[model samples]
Target: MSIAIVDARGWQNTLDLKTGEKIDAAGPVIKLVKDVLQRHPYPGDTDPGSNRWVSDTAFDLIDRYAPRFVFLTYAAQYFSGRYTPMSKETRARMISDVFLEAERFINRSGFAAIAVGTGDMTPLLGFIDVTRLDGLAVCTHWSTRYAGLYGPSPDDMKILEEHPHIEKIVSQEEVVRLFDGTPEQTLRLPEYLMLAREGYAFKTISDAMRIPVMIPSLNFNVPLHAPGHTVEAITGIRQILEEDLSEKNVALIAIEGVGLDEFLWPHRPCRNSTEWYYYEPGEAQYLTIVSGRHRFLDYPTGSGYKYFNGAEGAARSYPFSGHFKSIPEGAFASTFPGKSIAVGNKSMFMHMVTGADLSVECFARNLYNQGTMAVIHRADKL
Candidate 1:
């Protein structure tokens, strides 16, 4: 039927009143619930505040509405007191206890299903007994910071291993695939079969072949800095859509971060090479070039002269197919623009393209190592 999406922050007595006064400790919790519900209408004569008086109200709403699903959205750090002036451990336990109580209530009430909407609430996902919930979902943008917030970490894997209720953990690839289009197909027939099927006229025949349709390459420049280090490497990637590669598309991805231990902190100069690379749509071609601390790499098959690194130099480009044998640690990769690129111990090759064409073959060839052998095309015209 219908669903109730509860924001725990709204229920807390932390809002500024119309009179510019804070809700007092003696303020009734029901009043807070009523205030929130008043903003969101209720059906029939049902009182939104009444159901919230006790934690059971969460379940009561689900049961009464008989909604196809009930969603709970929360900020884990805020709920666990990381953002507030409270004991972190104590607040985490308190929030966990409240949710556990809510789960117990939901179990007693026969509702369709309960889903938790983690809006950048990754840390709390592990803290909760997700196994008891019917379903769970995470949503966030594709920036490095947001990706780190929502992406599964070691802690998440541990929780998945221990919890059975976590039916699925959606990935960025899957989400992107949900928005891609299907492939086109054609059939071939023998001359006799064609004649038997229909009145055939003589026509020129072409070889059975799959010609690669090259999409225009987009350039992404990212800056990297590390203090007191002799050499630092920065890398950046962005997902590109096939439709966005048209000649009319003028958008370009640019770098915005200076090298530093913490990306949000100030920048300092260090000896480093900043590189940009991306995959060609519908083809296996990895194009990469190094700019800083060295001359720009040469295009695969172009003739251009450029100088950098305090000397007359030339650029040399290479196909990244199988070239990225390893990805260094501290290197950051993202499908969205405006993310810093850092290189550490692990060898990595990351790319982000425009549009919604997120084929598994392209993703695995560019990011993860587990995939079929990818054919790398060297740019003959540069």
Candidate 2:
């Protein structure tokens, strides 16, 4: 079976089987993606067929071709709707209605929808019925928490407070409850979003709105934003990735490589697929993930420092390891880099981390057979 990409505008594009995860979205996934949009219908345009991507052709292709994978862009995400003239309530309901309709249609058509986006989707939690949904919608918030970095679009705090069933969602019992995660630099949002795109499943920001969210992993490109260009943002993003040791660097993005896989490139029929990468000129070659079989690179890329040196290029991603190590606090404190007394076959070293970001850990660690195992460092020490 073949695959296809659906843009946020609700248009379709033939999925390039060769590119793997960088799936191109053209045909209408966005309801207005290709509308050139005349609302009242110009002349005979009254017929739905007047529009191409969202017209009969797209749905017909969906029915006939019946692709094995349907990739939906986050054309409907928080940033996507900011420009719309709709009020917060109208916008929420409008986007909610669009997604619910898409969910029902995709379900009825018998295909899993890997809904993709770039920000805190938790706001929509109050407005969406996730139980009836299948597949996943991958995006990033601050660390595994649903705390939105920017404006927290549509502000679920206000929405849920007004919701009659808000109790089921909020942590506080007060009717004036409002949900807020952590607020840091807005510059980091793009990099974190890119991390979401990288499928790192890093630490997700949390809040009362924090729910176990994300869809599937499949290599696809949503062509959004990249924040590594600036020295501060790039340096900050890299700090969290390589080491979020200090509180100062912690807020940039979650360094925990927990749900890295399941958030982006899906792990299925692609089960046979190994080594996930997104490489380009002068940018860091994100090794992202190497799944399934027990495999390791013979030689290290040694490009660790490049990511922060302003190479403005891709760093050979190696600090990322599919292995998780937990160090017992007291004894493990002495077990610093390259001098640990852990049990292992060959004498070797790896970048180790604790499972501080629970939400991201839960989302990423179990993505595939390679799986994520936690080291009980703190608990063991305690």
Best by lDDT: 2
Candidate 1 all-Cα RMSD: 29.0
Write model 2 residue lDDT over 1-382, tens digit each, in one string.
Answer: 1121222222333333223233434333222212321121111211112121122222333343332222121122222232224455864554454344444444455533322222222222222221221211122221221111222234434543353432232121111112122233122222111122212232321112233333223322221111222212111222223332221111111111112221332212112112232111000111111111111111111111101123434433221232211211211123222111111100011112211210001102111112111111111211
Instruction: Score candidate 2 by lDDT.
Output: 0.22
How much is 122 displaced in model 1, in angstroms? Answer: 10
Report backbone clashes per prediction: 27, 50
- At residue 9, give the lDDT of candidate 1: 26
Off by over 4 Å in 2: 1-64, 83-86, 112-382
RMSD of each: 29.0, 23.2
Per-residue error (Å), model 1, residue 84: 1.2
The window of 10 residues in a row where model 2 has the poorest summed lDDT is 339-348
Please state the error at residue 246 of candidate 2 in Å.
45
